[model samples]
Target: MAISTIGFDADDTLWQNETFFRLTEQRFAELLSEHGEHQVISARLLEAERRNLAFYGYGVKGFTLSMIETAVEVTNGQVSASVIGEILSFGRQMLQNPVEALPHAEETLAALSGRYNIVLITKGDLFDQERKLAQSGLGAYFNAVEIVSDKSADTYARIFSRHGDGPERAVMVGNSLKSDVVPAIRAGSWGVYVPHELTWVLEHEDAPEGDPRFRRIESLAELPALIAQMT
Candidate 1:
């Protein structure tokens, strides 16, 4: 069956995401190491994030607060104010820095625009996602931009409904194995996995082996030919 609608994931799928976080984390590790083991700070932050998902969701703002909270906890309120200032500065840079789209992201998206209904399915803080979209300059290619709190089977189903395509007529393309593939497949859509150079550890999962409806491509530039073959 030919695909009528395509859902694309944001962040690492189109523009760099994890790299910023990774760089920030390294800075964070350096500062926390001054107190004791870096792992202690890492563990505390993860625990706080797990606890704060409902309260904070995704973005630099929440992440910065989580880092600050973890630092205070790990240091028993002895973490230096200077270190906190550095983390805050890092977060500000991440937010304000302009982002460049991944290789072939713009071109492929342009090619796919008129041929198929394209939608951006992203999960993150609304403001941050919007800021990135505005900066990306690829927003015009998308028929819709969805800022979902989570990517679940139900979320895909709902989005499919709104797009006027049933799961059978839609395809999902993204970097994350968990968010972009699993839920999409569960909702009965075709899923295409385009692995990014750096995937978040939390988003890592096993792909469905030999699934006829699932296709994995190495890069976005390969998508047009793949879609042509599928159609």
Candidate 2:
């Protein structure tokens, strides 16, 4: 079947997201300089994020809690209230950060909007994801919006079935091979990898070699052409 729907990931795929997280992490390291080296701090924070995913899920709120948890762990519970306050401020700053569309993001959406059913299929804190979409000014281009808790084969199957023709007729586009590409492909959708400069470590996964449904593009600019070729 021809591809009837195009699913776009919101964060680093369409606009700047992981970049803010990177900046906040640098600030986190600076705030905890006395406790440990940046590398140690970052590793501990990542460990906390991985462990806490089931509890806190993904987004700045969870990241803030992870940083605070790491600070308390590294300091043996000696982390001061002032430092905790700074970490909270970092989270708030991240929440309020301006949304900047990545190069060709808007143009790609515009080019494909009418021809295909454009769905924003992203996973994250619901409010944060909605805020980014509204601020991005690209919401109008989407035929449907899905702010999911996580991306999985089941998730894609359900979403594409509801919003478009089905996973068999949908293409999932995003930066994360783990969350965006692999699961979507497993669900019977085309997985398009558009790697971002800064991806969260947990999201890293080797591409599905020899998978005919899997495609790759340097940026969103190449997406329209690729879709045309596929059709």
User: What is the TM-score of each predicted model, taking all chains together?
Assistant: 0.94, 0.99
* Model 1, backbone clash pairs (residues 3+ apart or across chains), number: 0
Off by over 4 Å in 2: none
Per-residue lDDT of 1-231 in model 2, one digit per residue for the tens? Answer: 899999999899999999999999999998998989999999999999999999998999999999999999999999999999999999999999999999999899999989999999888798999999999999999999998888899999999999989999999999999999999999999999999999999999999979999999998999999999988
The C-alpha local distance difference test score for the whole of candidate 2 amounts to 0.94
Per-model CA lDDT versus the true structure? 0.87, 0.94
| Residue-wise C-alpha lDDT for candidate 1, range 107-143, written one tens digit per residue | 9998989888899999988988999999999999999
Clashing pairs in 2: none
TM-score attained by model 2: 0.99
- Candidate 2 weakest lDDT stretch, 10 residues: 121-130
TM-score of 1: 0.94
Winning candidate number (lDDT): 2
* Best candidate, TM-score: 2
